[model samples]
Target: MEKMPAKQYEMGSSTSTKSMQPQKFLHSKRIGHMDSFSRHEMMYDPPSMESKSMPRSSYFNSSKPWPDLESDESDMENEIDIDNLPPIEVGPHEHRLQYTYWLWFSRKGTHRATDYSKSLRVVGRCASVQQWWSLYSHLKRPTALHPYRDLSLFKQGIKPMWEDPANSKGGQWVIRLRKNQIDRAWENVCMAMLGEQFLVGDEICGVVLTTRSPECSLSVWNRTATDHASTTRIRDTLRRILNIPVSVPMEYKIHCDSLKYVAISKGPLKS
Candidate 1:
C-alpha cells in the first residue's frame, strides 16, 4: 500500500498541553468465547462506486487540519487493494482477543444523503493483536480522513449501523475533540474496548471515529440503552481511558431516538 504524505499542522501555543499516556491501559484479559483459526479472514473486495466529491465550502478553509475531499480519495484508493493483500500471520503464541473485530469504512454519499449505510464496507478483520496492528498500521489516522468519512471497529457479527439487531436497542456515548487531540484519543479508546477494560461483557457492539471540520468525534456503542448501570460504567471507563476531564461533556443518544430524529428530518415518504 502507498503511504500518503502526512499533512503537517501549525499548532497554536494555546492548544492544550495535557499529555495522554495510553500505554498504561495495555493490560488484556481473555473475556469471551474463543474463535477458530479459520475465522481470521481480514479483507474483502468491497463493491466499487463512482467517487462523488463534495465541493469545498467556506467552512473548510486552509487553516483546517484535515485534508479536503480530493486528498481523501487518494487515501481511499490506497485502501482499495486491501482484499488482494496476503493474510496476516497469527503465531501459536500470539495473544487472542476476546472477540473477533472488523474494521469498517464509509463516506457520506451525495445521492443518498440520509442513507450513508450504502457506502459502508469492511476493510479488515482481526482475531488477535498481531492481526489488528497489521491492518491498523496501514490506514490513515482520523485527521487524514475527509469531514464526512467514518472509521468503525465492530464485533465480527455486528454491523455498525443503528438498525442492526445487536445495536437496535442500544446507544452510543459521544465525545467530540479538537483535531490535534483525536488521534491519541481514538487509539486509546479502541485499545480499551479491545482489552475489555470497560468490564461490560458483550455490551460493547463497536466504536466509531468520525472526522469533521474544526472537531472530530469518537463514540462507543453498547447493546442496551436502558441498562443504566452498564451505561454508566461504560461512560466512567471511557473518561478514565481517554483521560478526559469531568468538565468535558459526553452525550449518550439511544438508537431509537436517533432513528426517530432521522425519520423526522427526512419527513414522510412520498407515494
Candidate 2:
C-alpha cells in the first residue's frame, strides 16, 4: 500500500521531462518579445537625437561627469576658439617680410628727359627709414616702371654714381631680378642692405636698386673694386643669404669693368 507502481513512476518522469524541455525553450523564444527587444536595442544601437535637445552642458558645459557632454562641448568650443584665433606673431625669422619699394627715375637711359624732370620735381630726398617708406608706399611697383626707367637706392651718405669716391673703385655683386621675382628679390636686397648682412661689412659701400626692361636689378656695392677678396666674400654671402635658386645665374662685376662693358656693349655715347 505504501510503494508506488513502476509504471506510475515512469509516467510521472516522462511528463516532467516534457514540461522542463518546453520551459527551457521559452527563455530563448521570449528574447524576441517587445520588451526584450527594447532592452537589447538599448544596449546596442539606440536611436540618434539632435545634440541641441540635450542639456547644453551635455556637450559643452564643464560641470558633468561620466558622459560629460558639458566638458566635451566646452572642449569643442575651446577648440573652435583656438582654431578661429588670429595668427600669433612670431619673431622676424618666423615671418615673411612685406617689403616697401622705392622708385628712381634717371634722366639718361632710364626715361625720357620730360619724365625725368617730372619725377625730379615730385621726388624728395628720403634720408631716414620712415621717410623712405613714406616715399616708397606711394610709388608704382617695380614691374610697372617704364622699360627704360631706372631706379637706384643708396645709403644715406652714398650716391648712385660710380664716380662717388666711395664707389669709384668699388665692385658689385649683382643679381638681375626678373620682373616676376620683383617681390622676393627686392625683399632680399632690402634685408641684406638694412640688416648689413654682407660679409664685406665696411666694404659694403651701398646698394643700388634699378628697374629696367624685362628685369629689376639689385646690386651690392663694395668700397674697393680691385679687392678680389672683398668681392668674392660679397658674392658668396649674397648667394647664401638670398637663397638664390641654382637655375638662375648671377654675375659679379667691377665698376670699372662694368663701365668698360657698357662702353663696348652699348656704345661710346651710352658709356
**Best candidate according to lDDT:** 1
lDDT (10s digit) by residue, model 1, range 119-158: 6766667777665654555567677777878899999789
Q: Candidate 1: where is the Cα deviation over 4 Å?
A: 1-90, 269-271
Q: What is the TM-score of candidate 2?
A: 0.49
Off by over 4 Å in 2: 1-104, 110-129, 245-249, 259-271
- The TM-score values for the models, in the order shown, are 0.68, 0.49
The candidate scoring highest on TM-score is: 1
lDDT of 2: 0.45
RMSD of 1: 12.6
Q: What's the residue-level lDDT of 184 in candidate 1? A: 72
